[model samples]
Target: MELPYFITWSKQKAPTTLELSKNSPHAFHIVEGSTYRPHLKKIVDLSSMSYQASFGLRNKMITEAIKKQMSLFSIALPKHTFDLKKEVSLRLIEKAKRYSPQTGKLSKDYKCFYTLSGSEGIENALKMARQLTGKNIILARKKSYHGATMGALSVTGDWRNDEHLLPRQWTVRIPGPEEDPKGEGIERIILKHGSNKIAAFCLETITGGNGVYIPHPLYYKKIQSLANKYKIKIIMDEVVCAVYRTGPFFGIDHYPFLKPDFIVCAKAISGGFFPIGCVLVCNKLSKRYDDKILSCGLTHYAHPLGLSAIKATLDLTEQRSFQKHADEILMILTEFARDLSFRGFKVRHIGHLMAIEIQDKLTIESLIENGIYASIIRENLILAPHLNTPIRLLKSSLKTLNKLLSK
Candidate 1:
C-alpha cells in the first residue's frame, strides 16, 4: 500500500533507520537485533527524554495484552463496556485515583478518562471546562506549547500557533513567570476578561519547549486562589513532566495545597510505550457529569493494551530505585548547569531538562557532530535526557559540550 502525503512537523528527512523498518520481518521481531545495531551506535537521542521506560518491561506488558486478545475495539463504547470493566482498566482508574499528590490513599474525588494523545487530553479538558462553566475563553501562559492539534494549538501561545487560525473567543494569553514574577498576571487577565467569560486557565506546570521554566513556589497557589474565587477550572498540563519526570509522580504533586480541576498527562504515563493520554477530573467536577454523558469520546479510550502498559509503567515507577535515580539525575544536571554557567554557557535547567541559549548555532552543530542530538527550540539547544541516563554518559555529553563552548 502506498502512503499518502501526510504533513510532518520535522524539517529534516526521516532517518534511514525508519526506512529499514519497512524491510524487516514483522513476526516475533527482536528490537536488539542486527537491524538496529548500526543506527543505535550513530545517535544519542536527547530530544525529548521520551524513552524513559525500559524496552524489556514495555514489551512484556504488550506481549501479555496480545496473548489475552485485549487489543480489540473500534469506537468509544459506554463507560461500562465489558472491556473497560476488566481488571486492567479498573486498575488504571484506581492507579489514577491513588496517584493524587494531596492524599496518598485511594480517592473518590477524581475520575479518569483516556485519550489517543496528549493533545486530545488537552482538548477534552477544554471541552469539559467549557461545558461546566458555559464559557468559551481559555487563558494560556505566554510562550506555552500545548500541542499541534487545532484545539490544543488554539490555546498554545508559541510561534507555531501562527500557522493555524484559532477562534477569537480562545485568544486570551497571559504573561509567563518572568514578566509576572508574583503570578499577578493571571488575576489581571481574569479581571480584564471578566471571570464569567473565562472557562479555564491552562498551563504547563513546568514549561518545556520555550525553556524548562519552573514557576515560582507561590505561583500555583495564587492561580488556584483566583480560579477558586471565580469558579474557573485550573487545568495543569503535565504531559511532559508528569509520571516522575520532575522529582515527583506528577508535577502538580509539588504543589499539594493546590488541587487542579483537571490534569492533562501523556508522554511518560505509559512509559512512552503506547499512545495514550488522559484528563483526570477532580471529584466535584466528576460528580457533575456522573449521570450526564461526557461529550468527549475517542476510539482508543481506555484501550486494554494501553491499560496494560500503564499498569506496568506505574509499577516500574513505584520502585524506590526509580525515585533515587531521579534525585541523582537532578543533582547531576544541576551541577552540570552551574559548571556550564561558570564557563559562560547560559544554561537553564530543572530536573533532567535543560536549555542552553547562547548566541551560537555552532554549539548545536558541535554536539550533533559528536553524535549527540539535542533539539533546537527558538534558536537554543534543548536537552532532555532520560531519567535513567548513566552518569558517565551525561559526563561524556558535558565534556563534548564544554570542549566546544570553550573554543
Candidate 2:
C-alpha cells in the first residue's frame, strides 16, 4: 500500500514496515532501555545515532520536565516576555560556558538563539557571520552534511546539495581530510576566494553523515591559524556531535586550541522530546544586534516545552553516573572496533559514534534478521546506540553484529 505522505531521501516505500504496538501508536516502543517492534522482536537499535534518542527512549526525567511545562503553557511567543524562557536560556548559557576554551567565566561575552532544528541553527549562524563581516562567501569542506534547508544546504558539500545546486553561489568547496591529507587545501581555497569576501569557515567538528572522519590535530591547528590570519569567523557545527556523543559536552571541546565564533547544536539536546536547535554566538558578534534590528526570528523560537526538555537533558548530562556510563560505552566500542579491524574490517570511531566499512552491500532485511537495526550510510554501517543502553544488551548486540558480518 502506498502511503499518503512522501518520505525524504527515498524513491519508494521502505522495504519493511513496523507495526505499532497496541499499547502505543509509536512504532518502536521502549522497554527497559531497549527498543522493540510490536511483534516482540527486540531491536538492538544502533540507529538513533545520537540524533534521535541521545538520552535513550522514554526518559522519565525529560518526560516529566516537558509535561510540567505543558501543564503551565506549551507555547510562549516573543521569548523576552516569558520568565521560563529567560531561566532556561541562562541555564543553557552556563552549560555552554563550561565547555568554552576562552575564559569560561565570560558569560557576558556570549548569547544564545533558539531554532527548530540544526539546519535552522546553521542558517542563523551564516546570517550572523555574513552580517558581521559584510561578506557573502562561506568556506565549507566536501563530504559534509550541514543541514537540509536552503541556506544550510548552500554551505553543505555533500550530494544532497546537488539537488539544489544554484543556492551554492556564495559557497566555496574545500577538500576534506580524505582528499587533502595535509589539510592545506583550505588555505588554498581561502586565498583563491580572497579572504575578505569570505565571512565564515563553517564545518563539523567531526564529520557526521558523509563519514565519521576525524581530522588530525594539526589540521585544526592550521585552520585556527588561517582563520586568525584572515579574520574569518569559525562556525563549528555540532549537530551530531554535541551532548556527550563524543565523550565531551561538545565535540569541539576535544580541540582546545581552536576557539569558534559560533557553535551550532541540536540533536541530543532535544532528549527525544522536542525538536530544538541553538546557535551560541561570541559576544563580540552577538553584541552588534543589541541595539540594531538584526533581522532573524522564529514564531516558535523559544517554546517553553523545548526549553524544559533542554533543561532536563542538560541535568541528566551533568550527572556523574551518566558521564561514567558514556565513558564505559566508549571503551566498549573502542575495544569492539579494534577486534573488528583485526578481522579485516575497517572501523573508525570516536567515543560511541562508529562507522564500519564493508565490501558487500548490506541490506536492512539482513540487519533485522540478525536481531539488530542500524543505519547504513552508503557502504558504511553506522553504530550509534543510546548512551544509556544496558551493558549486557550492548555487548550482545555487538556479538550479533559480528556474527552477521562474519557470514
Clashes of each: 1, 0
Model 2 lDDT, full chain set: 0.80
TM-score of each: 0.83, 0.91
Residues 1-407, model 1: lDDT tens digits? 23355435543344112221211111111122354563422444565434234222224544564445454642344354664336554554454453435556544346787887888999899889999989989989777888878888898887878876777467698878867767876787788889989998889988887877777877777887888799888888988877766666677667666667888888777756678887888888888887987788876677666666676667666778867876787888788789988877777776667778756645444665575656677756776776656667666766776676677
Pairs of colliding residues, candidate 2: none
Task: Give the whole-model CA lDDT for all candidates, comma-separated.
Answer: 0.69, 0.80
Model 2 per-residue lDDT tens digits across residues 266-327: 88887667998889898888888889887998989977888889889888888999888888
Per lDDT, the best of the predicted structures is 2
- Give Cα distance to truth, residue 329, candidate 1, Å: 2.0
Model 2 TM-score?
A: 0.91
